[model samples]
Target: MGDGPDLIGRRLREVRAWRGLSLRATAELAGLSASYLSRIERGERPVERRSTVEALAGALRVAPTELTGRPVAPHTPGESEGHAAVEDLRGALRDIELDAVTPESTGGLRTLPELRHDVDRAAAASFACDYRCLGAVLPDLLPRVWAHAGRIDGARTLLIECLFHAFYLAKDLGYRDVGWSIAGHLHRAAEATDDPAWVAIADYMRAEAMVGAHARTRALEAVVRSADALTPDAGPAGQAYGMLRLSAALQSAATGAVDVVPDYLAEAADISRHTGDGNFGGQHFGPRNVAVWRVAMAVEVGEIDRVPELAEAVDVEALPLGRRAWFLMDVGRGLAAQRGRETVAVDTLRQAEELAPQLVHANPFVRETVADLLRRARRDAGGRELRGIAYRMGMGA
Candidate 1:
């Protein structure tokens, strides 16, 4: 594979140049320093935060994907299959949105229980980060759910679950537009159910989808509002409420509002104490999940030093595969940023990849960090391992 231009940095420089804006001007617009933006464009720094990418995109009047290079080309057969499935999903979503789905084309309508089983299977695949299996299941399952949604009780709930699977799959695969479209479908389906809690869940998903685009402030505000509207008790609604607080915490950290981060975390922690561990709405909330998000939030806000302490408190073995891998990824990212910790960083990242190859490889930050490590690798020392990781991430040897 060709050594492509530095992913986000190269795109940022090109877009800035095309717009005929000086580095200082763009920096001013994006509320960043000229020197910092210069380093980012020169590939001396990786654009690690989604908030930063969104800010730059806003300054340039472009979608965040323009900088992130999302919907990144499939590098493996499994990824290729996943991308192909997205095309089918796109058509299905379009047909559903337009009320054009035909029963004749969608095969016989599936019973609500059968549809629920299919959604459960998809959720399991998602929790395992098995995008290929999820991709295989959703294209056919979605249309059938849509068919049954109007005719059966509780079918719309199943449809919402299918949309959740679709949303996460698309987002994980870097199809931001598809994810956003699916989020819209999710919001509508939840609204149709007339449950404020489900609507709150959809609102949380929508905020997440928005973070991939522009409007970081809007996303954060929406989450906070939705979270405030819900009462924190024990059960699915409580879990949803806790998750919304977690989302707000991360978004705040992303925007450098560190002071408020702890408040949100504390609130979520309290709610988790009541709710206990849960898989409600596939969110995996509770004390353990909240602990995982604490580590993630620390990483997001550049509190790299706290990551080790926060990470140590969580029992990774108890978390789902995807959560475990992501927490490890965050740990790796934190370790990689510290001086004299390259070896540990590499090992942690490798562990994450070993647990879930799809999640690790799909992460742009991991690819960038591995490339940076490879650049500094001594031939006799860490070079071999870094090369292996780079090759697996399709960054070349």
Candidate 2:
């Protein structure tokens, strides 16, 4: 978050000038438009994707990390506060045993109605990838919901849904231990509730965590099992089924089963046609959501060129902020994969970062890509700027 935008731009311009290439020539080699590269070099914009930086490095005949200055050495200490916050949350979870929360100790707990409103707010914060906002609420929310869950008939299920969202937020913030812990708690909550749909939803969250963690085989298997477990009946169940199928297809795509993604998506589309799009109490299923996942699949399977076209067809602004940011990152990835598109890719990635710094910055996927770019970058201004980013990320420059 330091010096928000200018650092990468300076590095880009310096490298281009040092290479003794015209903007048009450099753009052509990098697969970026001349005008776009010109704007970037002139400090009119910033870069946010490692892929775009990689592309530029390729054009410049330098290592990707040379531009970013992120050394392969171990990072410096005391960087991100997220590490501390995650540890605090972990300790908090340990201190309060979910089983120990009884009905008798709910004297000062927030009412169910109030907690419901808080969950909605937390969900919105997650959609926006506002980790700071999410952190503020979850510490109190998690314990309160579990502490008073026994007294209310429907509260346990409601709280489980809240826990699902909390798990999702933690995963996005790169707090894997916290995320997995929350997932375990959620599964326990699902069991306690004794509801089929809730159980399926918990399974879905678990699968999602696997996929995010890059456990391709296990993720695909889990999604498939969950997809089958869901009954295609009316209401939220059908929506959950569709989402589960879509999730399976995405995992399939990741595993080079590109053909399976569309088929599964088609089936999901049929279900969503009737059930419509909306989070059926944290299911987050719908045609629109399917469309977003399609972009991701297309990128995953080497059909990088198709991503932007698909992304353009969808109204990304209409989606939730987190989803929108996620889509933009992929679009940038796709563009970076092609010739004459790196500049546009940079713009897309920057837009994504503006939408959600937590999703863009804290993501291991994103940071790894950035680190790779830095390692391959040349020893120049670009490399120095990249190193600055790496240093801030707790990785040495």
Best by lDDT: 1
Off by over 4 Å in 2: 1-82, 98-107, 211-215, 368-397
The C-alpha local distance difference test score for the whole of candidate 1 amounts to 0.84
Error of 1 at 173 (Å): 1.0
Q: Candidate 1: deviation at residue 175, Å?
A: 1.1
Put down candidate 1 lDDT per residue, 59-87, tens digits, no spaces: 89898877777767777998788888889
lDDT of 2 by residue, 204-295 (tens): 77776653223656877877787787677667778778877887786676555677778988898888888877777565678787788778
The global Cα lDDT (0 to 1) of model 2 is 0.66
TM-score of each: 0.95, 0.71
Error of 2 at 95 (Å): 2.8
lDDT of 1 at 94: 80
